[model samples]
Target: MKLQLAIDLEDIQGAIDLIQKTKDSIDIFEYGTPLVINFGLEGLKKIRAEFPDITLLADLKIMDVASYEVNQAFVYGADITTILGVAEDQSIKDAVKAAHEAGKELLVDMIGVQDIATRAREIDAFGADYIGTHTGYDLQALGQDPGGIKLTAAEEIKSANPDLLIIGGAISTVDDPATAAAEFKKLLG
Candidate 1:
C-alpha cells in the first residue's frame, strides 16, 4: 500500500535530486544497485545524512557475506536492503538476522529463482522482510530487458495479492519525476 521509487540514476546528486522532486509523493526511496556499485556505501551515508527520516532502501542485492554486507548497509543508514533468493539458504538466514538485529529489513530478490513457491516459503521461514519478483521489476517487464514482457503483467500481478508492494524505476526516466510518481500513486489507489 506504498509507492517505492527506485532511483537507479548514475550518481549521488541525481539520486538526491530525484528524491527531492518526489519525496512528498513517494513513500520509500531506493538507492538502486547501480548507485551502490558506483558510489559504494559512502553514497548511502551521504544520502542518509541528507534525508535522515525518509524510508531508504539500499538495493545491495547481496550475494555473499550476508551478515557483513547487511550490517554494513544498516551502519551506512539503510532501512531496508536486499539479498538474492538464489543465494544459499544460510546466506538468506544470515541476512535476515542482520537486518532484524539492526531493526531493518532484507528483501529477497527472486530474480533468477528456479522455483518461486518453494523458495518463498523457505525465505519466509528465514524471516526475510520482502520478496521481489520479476526481473529488474516493471522496467524489464515493459520491454527494457532483452527477454522483456509486457507491463500489463505488473497490474495483473498486483491484483493477485492484497499484501503486495509495487516498486517502480520508470519515474527516474521521465521529464517530471514527481508527476510520474503521483500517477503511480493514483493508479495504485
Candidate 2:
C-alpha cells in the first residue's frame, strides 16, 4: 500500500523540510488543510518547486468555486486536489471535470458528512479518483482516544478559532494527564 502522509501543524518551511526528509518513503505528500489555510497556495508553490517530481496532494477541502479552485491547485503543482462531500453535487462534478481536463485527480473528503454510505455511493458515480475521510476533532469529539491530537494542532486550531471550546484527548491518555492538560492550557488558555 502506498503511504500518503498528511502534513499539518507545520508552516510551509516545516512541511517542505518534512517532505525533504520523508520523500523517499512516502508515495504521496499531502499539504493538509491547516497548512494550506495558514500559508495559502504559496506553500504548494514552494514545495512543488523544491520537489519537482513528487506526487503532491493539496487538501483544499474545496466546497465552492470548484472548477476554479481545482484548476488553481493544479496550476500551483498539485497532482491531486480535494472536494468536500458535503458540497453540492454540481460542484463535485465541476471539480471532476477540472481534474480530468488537467490530467489530475480529485479526492472527495467526507469529513463532516452525515450519510457516509449515501454520499460515498453518490460520489462514486461522480468519478472522483478517491473517497476519503479525515478525523474531524469536533465531529469525533475525542470520543475516548486521548492522544491523537498534538500540541501543535491544538495551537493552530485555537489560533484559527479562538472561541472554539477546546477539547483534549492526548492529555487524558498520557501517563501524566495533569501535566499534559497543563501544557495544553498554557498553549491554548
Q: TM per model?
A: 0.87, 0.75
Clashing pairs in 1: none
Can you write out model 1's per-residue Cα lDDT over 1-189, one digit (the tens) per residue? 666777776599988998899888788888989899999999999999999989999989899999999999999999999899999989999999989988897888898887989989989898888887756645555865423222344575467653435455467777988887776666664
- The lDDT of each candidate is 0.81, 0.77
Report RMSD (Å) for each prediction in the order shown: 3.1, 10.6
Query: What is the C-alpha lDDT profile of model 2 across 1-189, one tens digit per residue?
Result: 244566777788877766665555456778888888899998899999999999999989999999999999999999999999999999999999999999999999888888889999999999998887555766456573333557767656566553322232454344554455556556665
Residue 99, candidate 2: C-alpha displacement in angstroms: 0.3
After TM-score superposition, the amount by which residue 136's alpha carbon in candidate 1 deviates from its true location, in angstroms, is 3.7
> Which lDDT value does model 1 have at 127?
82
Q: Which one is best on lDDT?
A: 1
The numbered model that scores best in TM-score is: 1
